[model samples]
Structure formats: structure tokens, C-alpha cells
Target: MKIYIVGSVGSGKTTLARKVSAKLQVPHFETDNFVWTRHLKGDIRNEIEVRDQLLQDAIILDHWVIEGVHKDWTDPGLQVADQIIFLDFPSQKRVQRIVKRYIYQLLRIEKANYKPTFSMFLRMFKWNKYFEEQMKPEFIMKCNVYDHKLYRFQTDKEVKDWFHQIQRG
Candidate 1:
């Protein structure tokens, strides 16, 4: 089973994905790792090719969870996804997470493939705007349009509960 988790920046999509993947003992493919050249360089990596390869490899396997923001750009990755999870935390929570994330990045504490930049906060705000103004409705529409099972969570606790449910199943 392949699961896809999507949400605005700082929405805990990656955190939830990691939990789900760990619970299921499934590999988690983070698009950020494939899309960025360095931790924060934002250089153009083969977004399409790498994403496609990851999807192809996972499809041939039995289980995995893929998560990221570039849902439209990674349409192929979502094709075989059995579940789609979206984090809909409040703006304040999102802001807090983003700020914490940036602080960690600035301190070189968050060692993910992406780096934190000064503009990351602005980007976070813009991302929130885009999601609120555009991506949310579009995502709901596409979720229904595609007829895939979609799960929405408002808090980290809910996400944790869902992970337990997945584990129990």
C-alpha cells in the first residue's frame, strides 16, 4: 500500500508521514530529498525523474508512504496511493512549527535535505496564503475528483491516533 501525505508548509505532514511509515514498517519517501540538491540550496534537482523513479520502485514493492507539498508536480507518485492524509492545523500552530523549523535550520539543527533560509518565513506565509486561497479547495476538489480516500487531521494528537489505528489494522 502506498500512502501520500499532503499539506501546507509547517502543517506536520512530514512528521505524520514518518509516524505512519514507522508504525507500518514501510519506507517513507520524502519529495524534498529528491527535489533539492542540498539541504537548503533549492537548486533544481530532477523533480520529475526522481519522483517518478521513487513511485515506480514503490509501486513494485508492497508498502510505502510518500509525503510532500508538490502534489500537482508529483501526480504520478500519487496515482497508486491507497490513502491521502492532509494536515489542517491552525495558522498559529503552523506559524509556530515554521518558526521552530526555521530556528532549527538556522542553527543547522534540522538536518533534512532542505536548508532554512531567511526568506523561509516569508515563504511559509506565502504558502499559507496559497493554501488558504488556492490549494485547500483545489486539494479537496482533486481528492474527490480522483476518488481516493482522504483523511484530514486538525491536530497532532489526531494524527497520532490515526497512526495507532493504522498500526492496529
Candidate 2:
């Protein structure tokens, strides 16, 4: 099974993807890995061609879960996904989660795959706002194209229930 999870930052896309990956014994791919290159200079985004190639490699897997906050760049995965999970958690809850996660990363309590910085923390809030104000409506509209494969959840409880149902099946 191939799954694609899309949502705003801190909407639990990564968390849900990890859980599904563990339960299904499938590899989980994060768009951040393809988008950002770790370097001493800074975290630089890969060229579009490079990012596309990396994403193509992951999605071609027999079974996998790919999760990200990216929309346009994720279209390939969306096209191929057997199931698309849209985490539609409230903005307030998402903001809270982002703050908590930022704190954990800052305190070194959580090991972040990417470098944690105050600027990045600030950007998270901006990104969240941008998502709510701009990207969300566009996303919803785009998702209609894949309505048959879409499974949207507005709460963590709903997400958990859906995950459990998938596990049972």
C-alpha cells in the first residue's frame, strides 16, 4: 500500500506516517529530506530537478508512506497514492503542537532530523498562518481531484480511529 499524508506544519503528518509505517512495516519518507540539504553553510533546498528525482525514487517503492506539508511538490505522490490522508486539525491545535515541538528541539529533548533554530521556529508560525490563509483552500480544491482516495481528519481522535481501522483491516 502506498500512502500520502499532507497537512500544515505540526498537523501530525509525520507522526501519523511513522505510526502507519511501523504498523505496516513500510518505509516512511519525509519531503523535508528531499527538499533540504544539510550543509555547514546552512539548510539549503535542493534544486527542483534533484528534489523531484529523490521524490520519484521514494514513491516508486512497492509500499511506503510519504508525508509532508508541501503541496505542489507532492503532486507526484498524490497521483500514485492508494490512500491520501489529509490532517485537517484546527489552527490552534497545530500552533500549540508546533510550539511544543520547537521547545523540545531547542532544549535538545528531541532529536531533530533538521537543524533547529530560532528563525526556523519563527518561520513555523508564519508557515502555519500562510497555510491557513492561503494554501488550505487551494489544497481542498486540489484534493477534490483525488476525492476517491482522500481520507480527511479534523481531530487527532479521528486520525487515531482511522489508523486503528486501517490496522484492523
- Report the Cα lDDT for candidate 1: 0.77
Clashing pairs in 1: 39-113, 39-114, 39-115, 40-115
Model 2 earns a TM-score of 0.95
Off by over 4 Å in 2: none
- Report lDDT per candidate: 0.77, 0.92
Across 51-115, the per-residue lDDT of candidate 2 in tens digits comes to 99999999999999999988787899999999999999999999999999999998999778877
lDDT score for candidate 2 against the true structure: 0.92
Q: Note the residue pairs that clash in candidate 2.
A: none
Tens-digit per-residue lDDT, 4-87, candidate 1: 898888898787788877878899877776665552335666666775675577656778888887767677666677887888
Q: Backbone clashes in each candidate structure, one number apiece?
A: 4, 0
Clashes of 1: 4
